[model samples]
Target: MTKDANAATQEKLGGILEARDWSRMHEAWHEDVVDHDPAPDQAPGLAGIVDFWKEFTTAFPDVTLEADPLVVTDDFITAVFTIHGTHTGPFQGHEPTGREFTVRGIQVSKFVDGKIAERWGSTDQKGIEEQLQLGTSDAQFVSKD
Candidate 1:
């Protein structure tokens, strides 16, 4: 991938997150995108991304991503951003808590052709737990990972 191609892939990724376009995300991602689960037990892939976003974006249609600088290279890219959303529905098997939260995370993506070949990202686990009113020490979450 050339530098231009890299930048375009990065831009498209950011757009996917910003638009909350699950269909586009399914299209833009490779069948196997890697994710660095804060909960290490959770393996990462397209199914993980799709499941999380499908429920999250559905609950928070106003979810948005914000950031400034995005790194682009020949076949890799990274973006630092904050995702903001409100809890308007169920999450993590918990009932609505009606809480709003923002989580800052960074993602590095490997591109092959025009699609994301892989990805690894991290975000605020504590904040999510807090927002969901799930006890911080919930053992089920550990097992769920």
Candidate 2:
């Protein structure tokens, strides 16, 4: 079960984030998946989640997420990750800044039948804004290779 959960999570992340395969989302997310921390103006359920990602990808076409070691227990998996991207399009009512940013985030997902049924998490939005507006760097927050 753990292996299944891990594989599902990996496939979900890779397919959506890396490959930009929105069509495969249904295979990894339950139809009624709950997001505990939905973004502002985001709707409900799987379609909403997909819409959110679509908008996000539009804003940062070259975005990438690098996750640290995951913590899995039973039906739950938690990951700490860093989001790297450049603001190249409109986002949250703000025009493009063309600035690169790195923001850290953590997400906890609950899997049911190998699909993500629920998730709770938050990212450093304030930090991202600072990087964009002030042209500050998040180098201090980045993980060492």
Candidate 3:
């Protein structure tokens, strides 16, 4: 049961990303889905999910997410994915840098029926900032000779 649900959810996500279809979000997420780690300024529910993706795709028009094999247990599905994109548009109050970045993320989702009811996730924001030369981190790589 859980495996079937996970497969469906994965397929739906793939379709959504591949087509950049925000309208089809309801096919994979419950109407009142809870995102435990919502993006900054992202609202609640499925609409928030759609908005987040829309904003993300706008910022990184060629963004792609590649997931490792999913791990399913009970009603939970865990996915580790790599996100690759170029900063081609405004994002988070910063102008486009025209730089590319690759970051990793992990999400754990709880499925109810066949749709995602709740989720928690984290992405490597610092890595993105460093890659894009954004944010205020002053640390520099030094060689030990």
Highest TM-score against the true fold, candidate: 3
| CA shift of 79, model 1, Å | 0.9
Q: 1 or 2, which is superior by lDDT?
A: 2
Pairs of colliding residues, candidate 3: none
Worst 10 residues of 1 by lDDT: 136-145
Clashes of each: 0, 0, 0
Order the candidate numbers by lDDT, best to worst: 3, 2, 1
- Give the local distance difference test score of model 2: 0.75
Output the lDDT of residue 53, model 3: 82
RMSD of each: 4.2, 5.3, 6.7
lDDT of each: 0.65, 0.75, 0.78
Q: Which stretches of candidate 3 lie over 4 Å from their true place?
A: 137-145
Tens-place lDDT digits, model 1, residues 1-145: 6868777656676677667666777566777766544233344777767666766666666777775457888887777777777778876666677778776777777788767776666666676677656657542221111
Tens-digit lDDT track of model 2 for 38-62: 8777778888788878878888889
Residue-by-residue lDDT tens digits, candidate 3, 48-81: 8888788788888998888786788668888888
Per-prediction TM-score: 0.76, 0.86, 0.90
